[model samples]
Target: MKFLVLCLIALIHQSASQSPQASCQFENSIDYTCVLTLTNPNGLNNITEIEVNHMPNRTNDDVVIVRTSIFSTSRNIPSIICDTFRNLRSIDMFRTGLTKIDEDSVSNCKLLELMTVRFNQIADIHPNAFAENAELRTVQLDANNLTSVPENLFENNKKLVEINLSQNGLAVLPKKLLSGLSELRGLFLTHNQISEIYEDTFADATNITSLGLGNNSLTYLPDKIFSSLYNLLDVYLQNNQLMKFNPYWFQNAKSLRALYLSNNGITYFPEDSFVNFYKLRELMLDRNPIQKLPGKIFASLGELTWLDLENCQLVYLDPSLFLSTYNLWMLKLANNDIYELPGGVFGSLKYLATLDMTNNQLQAISSTSFYFHPDLRTVRFGQNQINAVDEKFLDVVNVTQLNMEQNVCADGFWNDDSETKELFRTELRVCFENYIEPPQYCPIGNEYERICELEAQTASLTLENAGIRRDLEGLAARIEQLERLISSSP
Candidate 1:
């Protein structure tokens, strides 16, 4: 019988290539979109509608956006398996070790608009999960393990614009939980464990424009909680334990722009907090314990541009503290106890560019220290007690990365060569040729006491020219011993 019909057609092509939908790895797209990747689904739980009717040349109504990545599946997500993709609009369930998400999972993907259960271990979600996916606009349950979420979840997704519960473990947020997200604009509850936030919790999410409560464990914040966020723009309350900084919490968020209060416990900032933030532009109060700042506190933040007061234990600053931020360009007063920088304190920052006074208690760098930066570029006076450096301090700023490491000269006297600015101005005239007088709270002026009296009269004419070159080498060795005793007495 022709060897038993070729051994039954090689045992039916090795049992149809060991099927379990052949370990799913489909790709169909040509508008009928379907990207099913089930890697490591070794204990394959279920995806059978006979595996979407054996998806080979696409069939279940010719699929419609099903993007799935079920890696290392633990369980629960097979609930009717998206009711066989009822012409699903979009469903991306990545890293599926999914834990809870009831309500028939995708409620039969009722023309779902976009749902990405990202990095799952999903804590619990069935508050009518998506209540029949009312054209859900976008919902990426961010890096899940969500602590709480279901104040009517998305209350029937009123075309929800974006909702990413950032790195979840959320502490508390259900204040009507965006009750009717009027096309919500971008709400990312960053690294949650949120201490408190229910002042109407975004009131109705008034057209939110990027709000990411950073790190979170917030100290206090219900002063009108953002007043009603009138078209707010970028507000990430960094780290958080905010001690004080409530200018009525943005008295109506005047279209705010970038305010990340870095690792807070903020020591101060009441002076009109930011007087309506005049279109604020990137202000990050770095690691706060702020010693002093209220010099009209950024006056009204005249369109500020990136200011980060690093490690604030600042000793003093008010030289008009950035006088209206003259369109600042990256300023970071590093590790402060700032000894003194007062003279025109950065003189209205003429478009300053990257100034980080590293490890302060600065002794001297005066020549009006960066004399009004002409587009200054990278100046980090490392570990200060800088033994005076103004031989016109690199002739008035044009710094191209000058990090005077562990100051007081002698360590190759600092370098980053703008051709070492005339070799650090001839090594600051021989490392301070006995240069002293700097104290009177050193903001250094009296023209630095006339350049330390012309570097002490040029170190006393360089010790009278090394004592006339050692008396002309001892009279040229007594004229070579009187010409060898006059040629040995003739």
Candidate 2:
């Protein structure tokens, strides 16, 4: 009798652990894969919420998820549903008129990994909305009306990696707002009204790799705000009202790859400002009022590739400005007041491929100015005072396009050698005539070895002319002395 009781106990335990197979219908839609779904039951009760008792046993239950479309019209997600969908992985909702999430709504969703409630009118959330949902990894609440979030809302969720709360009315981030998410890799808060961020807002989020604060009203960021994020990769601070860049802002973020600070009122960048970003690659500072960049500002960013300083109202650039940016590929300096490019300005950018200096006040460029860049392919010097071109400018053997149109030159400057002009594919139109004396329109050497030989000849002639002028001045002084002596003697 004792043995028979043991067998009966074993059978009951197996039955409790295994759930019955749930019936499902295939939706056959392109965007969604068919999964275990719950349809509204027909009856007077109407089943306002799903309870733990309504689900099958844990062992037999398949992964359950609430489709985004169905949740769009759903009113709420009760705390009881967490018990029913114990094996659930995701819960998506949108446009459901969800105004608030009460406490413990999804506290015990042990297997929950992803949740999205975007494009809704949700304005509030209980502190325990996801209190103990440890397995939750991604939460996307973009396009909501949320003004504030619980400071400890994600305190119990250590596995949370990404949180996107963009397009909201958040004006400020409270300190410790994202305190417990230690594994977070991405935090996007773009297109908001955020004017300030607390110093300790990201105190515990050390693993964040990408942070977006663009399209906001931020005028300044507190010092050491991102001092702990060592693995940070990308930062977007565009479309803000920042007046300056603090040198200590990215002191600890050395693994940064891309930085965007475009469309701001930044007038200057401190020297050695990017000394900590050793592995940075892409930097965009376009559309700022920066008149100049400090020398050695990009000294430590040796791994940089793309740099955009377009429309920054720059009047001049240091000759060694790009001395450390040897690996730079694409550089855009279009729409500035750069009157001239000194020799060897781009000597350090050996890998530079595309250079855009269009719409500037460049009057002349030396023949050996681009000598270091052997891999250069395209160059744009249009709409300037450039009246002459040398064969050395086309030294890059693989150069495909050279835009020199709309400048001071004769219309038939390159017409004498139509073959080489066709081979180079340059826009050598005569937009203006040279007004200077002697009209230095000569380009030394042929297309193969375009050296400025006339420059040397001009230098020799200038020295001879200077000697004659000195002799004439000396002779005039002696004649004046003789005239004075003659008058005094009389």
Index of the highest-lDDT prediction: 1
Report the lDDT of model 2 for residue 236: 96
Question: Against the unseen true structure, what C-alpha lDDT does each candidate score?
Answer: 0.71, 0.69
TM-score of each: 0.33, 0.74
Candidate 2 residue pairs that clash = 391-450, 392-450
C-alpha lDDT of candidate 2 relative to the true structure: 0.69
lDDT digits (tens) for residues 1-490 of candidate 2: 9999999999999765342222223233332222333332210112344422223333224535645344223345545445555676777766655556767667767788888788877788888888777898999889988888887878788899999999988898767768777899999999999999977788889999999999999999999898888888999999999999997888888889999999999998988689888899999999999999875788787899999999999998875577688789999999999987754467557678889998899876554455334466677787877775544344322355567667675222122223244544344322212222233332222221112232323322222222232232222343443344344442
Model 1: per-residue lDDT, tens digit, 84-151?
66877887778767767777778888888888888878888889978988988889889989899988
Worst 10 residues of 1 by lDDT: 460-469
Q: Model 2 — which ten-residue stretch has the worst lDDT?
A: 443-452
